[model samples]
Target: MKPIEVKNLKKQFKTTEAVKGINFSINQSETLALLGPNGCGKTTTIGMLLGLITPTSGNIFINEEELNYKDHQFLNIMNFASPYVELPKKLTVLENLKVYGRMYLIKNFKEKIDQLIEDLNLKPFLNKRTGELSSGQKNRVSLAKSLINDPKILLLDEPTASLDPDTGDYVRSYLEKYKKENDISILLASHNMDEVTRLSDYVLMMKEGQIIDHGKAKDLIDKHGRENLEQVFLKLVRQKNEH
Candidate 1:
């Protein structure tokens, strides 16, 4: 079975429906990109996956265990990273990781933290409070914390947003390498077309709370007669709008 699965998942907030019965899954060692414009239900769908926002109707299965607000066990083996989410402002990088490590009941805490520090090159500000670090540095730290549990499943939203090209490239390459070595399944939601093309094994394009298209990145681009993902995204959005 795939590590992550969603079946006819949906969510509604009062009078509005944010997600219209979408279905998808991420396999072991696979990366699925959720692509769409702003307010296309990407965030809402992710929120449901994380169990932060209750789904009006649907089922989420992580490692074959159904997930809901009351079932917190799924969290032990899953994690998420997003530029919008920040580590404790007053906690040092090491402190933040240590907290997460303890929560995840990680064995060999020191050894694990040391290895992650080395892997992410976080020694420069290991003891510095998170708020003191620059965006790139914070992003790396967030990524490090997300892996403290050695999760088999990861959810990412604009993970490299607002970073410089070098930093962005570093994150993309690191994710690629990490996924290869650990066989981690990732669901990435990002507006950056280039990043999606580089990382995603499959793509699901959403609009108006529904998946309008889904396929390999190259196949979608070719199918739409677009030069690249960005153009395809534009064309899809426009076409959906015209309907």
Candidate 2:
């Protein structure tokens, strides 16, 4: 069983049809990139996987077990990180990590928190309120919270957005090393083509609530006769619009 799998997933918000029967899976120790334009159902799909939204139809499997919304034990093995998702503004960085660690029922929580603080360089502002941190600092804290559980599966949405290039690169490099050493699976959604190409072993391109194209980033670039992912993305989005 794959670490993450979606079988014929669909979501309908009244008549909007936010997701249209998509299927995909993430293997152990691999990263899959979900790429699409704004409102192309990327967020909706992630919402379903995270159990934040009920799917109108279809199923989700994590660690080979079917995920039921009411039974969230499966979620202990999964975690998500997003720069756009806010942590408690009033809580200090250490306080926020404690909250998430407790939520996951992590044993040896202090050890885990300590390791993450050092790994992500969060020690300097560990006692500062989350809202007071710069964008780069906040991003690191979000990442540390997500890893508190030492999850088997991770979902990241624009994990590096709004950071200076140096900070962004640091985060990307950290994720690469962490994934390899921990053998975790990742499902990443980002507009950063370079990030996607570096992190993803497979790619799923969505359009209008459906997967319009998918393959290795290199394969897609070569198939589309483009030099890189950004160009390929432009071609796909514009081609659909013209039709």
Candidate 3:
């Protein structure tokens, strides 16, 4: 079954249409990449799916149930992670995880926290204030917090944006293992083409508020006659202003 379905999705600001009639579906156990340049509406689309924003017109279905901003029953089944969004700066890593675990009403909060701390290698910084951590450390904590609830749908924006190569690779490997072991579905929004190509089974390319192209990752690369996903991405976006 598809974990997410979006039809005729649209969002508009006072003078600009941020998202325009985009349609897509993300299947269970699949990783889908939403790729685009700065103003292409990837964030807006993600916000709507997470119930953070109301779409001007659209339909979003998650796990076969329609999502309503006013009544979100499946909020417990979903979680989001973004470096741009931070956990409470004053809270320690463990504290933030504990609060989220309580919010999710996890049955064995301590056990879950313990497992995450070990798996993410977060034990050393567990008691440190979130704001005091380096960028890489904060990213790790953010990821741990996102997984505190054991969500089925994980929405990640630039999951490896600022980390050193080794740490970034570790994060990617962890996500790969997590998804394979748990059958989780991930929606990843990123500018890192290598990361996207490595993790995503399907690719959606958006430009100026609309999806200009989409297909399996390999198919998109081949169709654009590009050496890699990054080249394919540039070809599509550069064409936006030409025509």
TM-scores, one per candidate: 0.98, 0.98, 0.98
Could you give the candidate ranking by lDDT, starting with the highest?
Answer: 2, 1, 3
In the range 140-181, model 1's lDDT, one tens digit per residue, is 999999998898999999999999999999999999999999
* lDDT (Cα, tens digit) per residue for candidate 2, span 81-198: 9998979999999999999989899999999999999999998999999999999999999999999999999999999999999999999999999998999999999999999999
**lDDT score at residue 41, model 2, on the 0-100 scale:** 99
Model 1 residue 22 lDDT? 93
Q: For model 2, how many clashes?
A: 0
C-alpha lDDT score of every prediction, in listed order: 0.93, 0.95, 0.93
Checking candidate 1 for backbone clashes, the offending pairs are: none
lDDT of 3 by residue, 24-114 (tens): 9999999999999998999999999999989999899999888978987778899999999999999999899999899889999999999
Cα lDDT of candidate 2 equals 0.95
Distance from true position, residue 219, model 2, in Å? 0.7
Q: Which residues of candidate 3, in runs, are more than 4 Å off?
A: none
